[model samples]
Target: MLALERVSKTYPNGVEALARFSAAIKQGEIVAIIGGSGCGKSTLLRAIAGLDRASSGTVTLDDEAISSPHAKIGIIFQEPRLLPWLSVADNIGFGLADLPAAERRGKVARALERVGLADKADAWPRELSGGQAQRVAIARALVPQPEVLLLDEPFSALDAFTRRDLQDHLLDLWADTRPTLILVTHDVDEAVVLADRVLVMRPRPGRLFDQIEINLARPRDRNSPLFDSFKRNVLTSLDRSLDRNVPDRDATQGPGQAMWW
Candidate 1:
């Protein structure tokens, strides 16, 4: 389980990314964080990942304190961030630099097989399509058998068909590994379809405004009334949060630089 206690992030420039945010996530669960563009969902993920420091509060994985640096949290960012010069297999195995050659090969092969990319093991990043590259990213993150997987809009860039395919693949991967997942995405349907719980965050010094449990059975049908209600509820919560956060003048200022909650 993951526990976030009074977690907050305030930059020196006076921008408050998170303010007194707290939540608990259990093992074998998929949670989605949704919010306005600048609501600090990504910042919260970064803080938890130890990519950035929180000005206050504490984060712990199964009660172990997380300080300046975090360990065992695997992350997949918006981009693949793969090495241009390395083959897909090499990129997936990059984090396992200290492992023995044979062990690393086994791990890489298993990961590729999970992502359906074993055939592309030797292929370069340039040779893969958007969805393929994202799969490579997923494979790399999964190779280590992380206790938690943090994905920041991993499939947001792909076309609709590709996105749906990858989403299904992700669900399958999660079912197989059962790692606690925290996905930050702007897509309401994606959140409803994938997450066991969806957390809606308010902007500027973000705080949790809503905690929604997705009751629809999996594999969720996007067009089903149950799924639609869940999506509508999440979006409504997000809309209300944004309206309450943005000033009257700023409301006319166009979409805030917020990210998905």
Candidate 2:
């Protein structure tokens, strides 16, 4: 189990990015954290990955405090961050240097196959399309077969069709081998479709505002009324949280400027 107890983060500039946030995630469960810009989603993900330290409270996985980077935890960022000179297979095996050459090759091969990129194993990063590059990134992250995976808007940059394809791929991988995954995304529909639970956060001292459990079955149909209902609930919760965070509309909005969501 992964647990965050009263966790908070404050920068040296006195900006409190995260408040007393707390949540318990089950083993192998997928959780999505969503909020507006500057809601500390990045900070929270980094802290959980032990890339950043929480100013207060504690984050633990299986009862062990996460004070530094853990080998069992893997993070996927917004960009592919692949080395331009490396082949797809080599990039996926970058972290496996400690293993024997044969073992590393085996792991990389399996990961490439998992991401449907076995044919592109020898291809350079520049040779792949946007979606293919992201697949390589996913393969690199999954090569370790992390028990806990943290994704920070990994597919936000892709086109709608590519994004949907990657989402389907993610679900397939999860079904094959469930891992405790946390996906931080701003897209409400993405969260509803992908997460076992949705955490709606409030900004300006980022904190959890609501928790929505997804009771729907796998291979979720976005066209289904049940999916629409869940999406509506998430939107309503986000709007309510915005209502609390955003001040009077007239004062916040620029003169003669309007915004619609």
Candidate 3:
């Protein structure tokens, strides 16, 4: 499991980005974090990725503490961030240098086939389209088969068609390994389409405000009534998190029920 215990972060300039936020995610679960601007969405993701340490509390995968970047954790940002000089195949195998050359080649070949980029194996980053580059990025992250993958608005920049295509493609890849996926996104539809649960956050020293369980099944139809209902719940919770005056819709189960702190 991936767990965050009383995680808090304060910048060197005396600004607090997160405050005692906590949650425990089981293996193979897909969780989406949504919030208003300045709500520390990226801040929290960085803490979990070990790119930034929390001022207090702890982040752990299974039983191991994470204070620095770990091999078991992989991160994908909004941009592909591929090496310009490297071919698509080389970029995907960049982390497999420790493996023998033949083994590395085999892994890279499989990744290329999985991402549907086998034909572009020798293509440079500049030669590929936006969606293709992002596919390469996803393949690169999955090549190592990390225990957990952290994505920060990875598909926000792509067009609607491309975004949806990649979302489906991502799920296909995810089903093979069942790694824990923690995503930070602003798109409610995307969140509803991809996550098992949606975590809403409050701004100004961001902290957990609500957790809405998406009971819908996989291969969900975007236009289905059930899918829309879950999306509406997340949207309403987001509004309440941003503005306290917004009336709560579901009073039965209070906010932060799934949170540890």
- The candidate maximizing lDDT is 3
lDDT of 1 by residue, 1-261 (tens): 999999999999999989999999999889999988888899999988888988999999988887654547999999999999999999999989999999999999989888898899999999999999999999888888789999998888899789899999999998887999999998887898899999998887788888999977888887887776677677667777877543343343233322244
- Going through the candidates in the order shown, the clash numbers are 8, 0, 0
* lDDT by residue for model 2 (1-261), tens: 999999999999999999999999999999999987788899999999999999999999999999899988999888999999999899999988899999999989988888989999999999999999999988888877788999999889898789889999988887766889999997777898899999988898999999999999989998898887787677667767777444443343332221112
TM-score of each: 0.91, 0.92, 0.93
In angstroms, give how far residue 25 of model 2 lies from its true place: 0.4
lDDT of 3 by residue, 1-261 (tens): 999999999999998999999999999999999988889999999999999999999999998999999999999999999999999999999989999999999999999999999999999999999999999999999999998999999998899899999999999999989889999998888888999988999988999999998988889999898876687688678877877554555542353421111
Q: Model 2, stretches more than 4 Å misplaced?
A: 244-261
lDDT of 1 at 248: 43
lDDT of residue 221 for candidate 3: 99
Q: What is the alpha-carbon lDDT of model 3 when measured against the actual structure?
A: 0.90
Query: Which 10-residue span in candidate 3 carries the lowest summed lDDT?
Result: 252-261
Which lDDT value does model 2 have at 90?
A: 94
By lDDT rank, best first, the candidates go 3, 2, 1
When sorted by TM-score, best at the front, the candidate numbers are 3, 2, 1
lDDT of 2 at 138: 85
In candidate 1, what residue range of length 10 has the lowest lDDT sum? Answer: 250-259
Quick one: best TM-score, which candidate?
Answer: 3
Deviation from native of the Cα of residue 129 in model 1, angstroms = 0.9
